[model samples]
Target: MESTAKQDPTAFKRIEFLVVTKNAELLSVSKDLVEHYKFRAEYSDSVDTVDADTRLSSSPMMILISLEEIEGLQERMKNLQQLRAAFPRSHIVAMVAGDESTDDCEMLRGSGARYLVLLQEIKNSSKLYYLAALLVQGTYIPVPVSDLFPSTQVNFNAYHKLVLNQKFLPVIFSGFTFSDKKYRQLETAQQVYVRREELGEYRKYIETYHDQVGAALKKRCRVMMMSLMALYSEILLLLSLDCEAGKKDLVQSKVSEFVQGSQDLGRYLKDCPDVWNVIAKALDFQFCRYERGPYILAYAVYISLKADWGQMQDVVMTALLADLGILDLTPESFKTLQKKNEKHLKPEELERYRHHPMNSLNRVMLRELEVSNETKSSIVCTHERNDLKGFPNQSPADKIPAEAQLIHFCELLDRRVRASLEDGILTHDFVRKQVWEEEKDSLKRFNAAFLDKIEKVLVA
Candidate 1:
């Protein structure tokens, strides 16, 4: 159980604690409890000896009276009865030693201690503090098993179902229930469902909640992303493990899971066009760059908006599929092509590369996807340059579509970032500076406002 201290910022603000125990050991336990939970606590040697008139006057949140003290001064029980009568809002808990008998337990329950905890049962005082906090908040915390038998299995499901769902005003008012293993289990289950690869299953789960689908989806997204991040961590661990004969199979399985999971999430985004826009925007700001394909698409969107360049969806999608033509190329050949000098390329070889944008665009268009004509046109012209320096038709600034211009900038940015990551370059700022120095004149032909916006966003 997590100490409610750090998690609940407001837990100690309103609750005043009273610890009434004569035993030096139990009194020390009470002091530790107060220190751990960061709560204000007052201790009295005996409940009967306590200044009831002064203690009751403060209207403390709760009073903790030891059962031994109560038994020693039975007449003080009358005083407690009167205090309860005078301050109906105050709560009292009876603390008992482990050696107390069953009859004593029943008597304390009958004596008006709303809750009872045994000293021996508490391994540490934080548990007592948590219990007291729950009581003060008016939550029905089940008697700890330790109070009965040390190391008993806690029925978390029943606890959440019964205690958390209770209609008590304080339970509702507190805004959070006690943190326990059961609470963690529910959180884990919700996260798994939220981040599951099957969109159909995820949507079905959301539908089950009916009226709260929107809120549920929002909550699920956080859980799902956190799960995905955790999965990525596992993948990293798998990659780092010492290789054995069977390790290759295990590592490949992990890779397959990661790829499939990402594809499933992408397909889900495809189903909701509006949601895709939001996802696209967020992906733009994410720092991870190991996945160049998705990052490139995100960068395209960012540039298109920054440039006020409409009709970019197809261009972005085309960029996504642009490398397909070279997929069949061997790893060595791919590296060679990436390193090839554009200035020395033969006319035919340059022409092949020039037509790649159109080739990719047509491939996607033929798939019967619901894309606009402007988007397709943007894809066809992405290679066109601003100073009439680019391929195919050597198109000038006026001839190139605004969307294509945005795509070109993003493509360059993607290339630079990837190269930097691969080569151990330290800063995005340095990369941007290099790009500006090399392409400054060409960039001038583009819309000034567009470049300004992009610069502001990148710097931010």
Candidate 2:
């Protein structure tokens, strides 16, 4: 039996969530479930009341609405759309009757709902509340691998017989998975697989819930590492599946998010000191995982400098596409450059390598990306020096962008660190000495103002 008493209005004070439904039973259950998960929520009898409540100081972080009415499903969906328009950042969960048509589920998804919860299942199962908690918090939780997926030993027929519900399970961290042992960290990307599924299912999941999925996956990774993974995976896709227009759009969208996230992280890290070492260690791990050492090095320094949002965006775009020209090189030429030693390259190889910045700019243009003029300049001038002694074009000191100057210094530092690592030197000590002691004079190759910013970050 469910309580029918109206929840006291005073209970809504300081609440961070709202549950909207005409059913008194659902109101009682939802209130209990949310409070059980340590979230305070207020109940509303209808979406109309929620619309009025939006004028309050703090909007709810999540809105759970019941859409089980077959007679007025369309009206309920319109209410959902209105709520979505009003609270764009709120996580909208639409509760259905589990046995609804696929078309109805799709409509619910299309109506701006971030999650679809079966009403009967929620009422009967304790475990489903945990899932609801995850949806509301947008946080990661490690679950047994078997709980989230069909048995790895299952045959084709047996696997097919399993429900498609597993596809909706948010079980992975980017390309990797965890061991079933209690809350273990990620082991390897190779250990996970979902076999013989139609691509449509994957696409549908990505379209509807990719952002929330990524948010839930952010446990060990902060913004920089996430941005690196996004760029790395999308670039791999672009390289392999160049014909996929949808992938290209995804890449562009991810780049924009990366910029926005970087801005947010920059503000957060500005007040913290001596935290860069920990961040560097995490970045080094990502570098090893993604095989993107230069990007990691540039990113580590880039975030530390705490550039304005506009400059950060331009520099990040440059860092991502600066080396894309290496993709155009022959395998042998690419391998030569991968050594991070230009002296080893033959004259022809060296010439081609020098022209890679221009090639990268050309690649960006060919991709039809909507980058700003500043970003274009940064990519082309990434290798140019303020001393007027660098690059294929030998662009003058005044011609270089400040964003390009920072990237150039980081690239130079990355090569130095890699060379020292090859000689069995510790990276941390080498970087400290190289930046503060040996590179004091070399810093003149960058703009004085830009170098001052780097100096402050290093000393801090």
Candidate 3:
């Protein structure tokens, strides 16, 4: 490792990171990370020593604190708070034991820390490096605490079929106000669809409540949703494996688990029907972050449609496998396709892109699973347009199944909504407005009546 003292002081005036830890293993790992990433860093066993250093008068970008396995947990947290108070601008990351309790973890977050991770999770040096990189880029990684939530629960009888009329909508969200102090009425809210103006405010109010639930609860729900996505990813991985025959039983078991989990999540959301809007936004945030983003987005949208358990399972299965063909494409090929416009694609590339839907259908048929005919059609027709302008056969609206339209609409909507959020715009309804008014011409590609019904289900 390069000696910090021998480095050019004038050139490396600002330290990029500061690692404070007493644990021998953590200290060793931190040294390796600093050497590997070439970070201008300072190391100390105590916060006081770091604070007293004259060169560190200007705070480092991030502070990594390791919590030792000691009896005086409160004392350690107090020291952490002292560090936070000293460098108010720096990002504080607390690394705690894997078996740490939820309450203790919450305490760490509450002590002005920006992030928390289990020490066990970073035992792998590669994982630690990845985590550090993400933190430096300001990506928020929610702690895994799904155990705090209740297990799979179903209570359709408790589902509230909220009729979102002007008179009833206010009563449901009795005390929600915007930052500017205007109350949210959701006047156009109905069992089917909300007006464009109402959708943005409606999503904002729900997101605010979700945030108000505190970090621990927020993380718990995020973990629960990510677990569902992990199962979907696992299934995709199994299908791509060489030993397909041997993996069939495992795939079947995962499929069963996913169906039950989806149903359980659906019931849990429906049971608190008044808050369905909130859960929808939350799921959107979670699903948009996962690798199989559209798959989970389709799941979230289908669940909102209020389908029966049997229909829900089929829709979920369809969503899960709808884009399986895309996996056959190399990573670079997919990246190029995503980054380039359709007009920029070469003839052969365009042909391959157009055939992915059929490729997916053929792959699924070969599996010989218990997938229904409706699911099979949905998987293949996901990209087909209502006006017969879509690919893989140009199936018209009449020929395209409802499940296919639902998933397709979700894939489009997710891109718009996620983009809006990513651009730092708070108005989610911006996407809805684009669909209903700005891009009404594009809506011709989808079933008009079905789109109306799905939009209503979204607001309801």
Evaluated with lDDT, which candidate comes out highest?
3
Tell me each candidate's TM-score.
0.37, 0.49, 0.51
Clash count per candidate? 0, 0, 2
Regions more than 4 Å wrong, model 1: 1-291, 312-318, 321-351, 365-370, 441-450
Q: Across residues 128-190, which tens digit of lDDT does each residue of candidate 3 receive?
A: 453354334222222211211122221111111132211111222223312211212222222
TM-score of 2: 0.49
> Would you list the clashing residue pairs of candidate 1?
none
Question: CA lDDT of each candidate?
Answer: 0.46, 0.53, 0.55
Error of 3 at 44 (Å): 33
Off by over 4 Å in 3: 1-141, 144-221, 271-290, 294-304, 307-310, 337-344, 436-442
The candidate maximizing TM-score is 3
Q: Give model 1 RMSD, 1 decimal.
A: 23.9
lDDT of 1 by residue, 89-200 (tens): 5567666555555565455545565555555434321334434433343222222111111122322222222222121222111123334553444443231111112222
- Give every collision pair in model 2: none
**Model 3 pairs whose backbones collide:** 192-456, 193-456
Of 1 and 3, the candidate ranking higher by TM-score: 3
> Which lDDT value does model 3 have at 264?
50
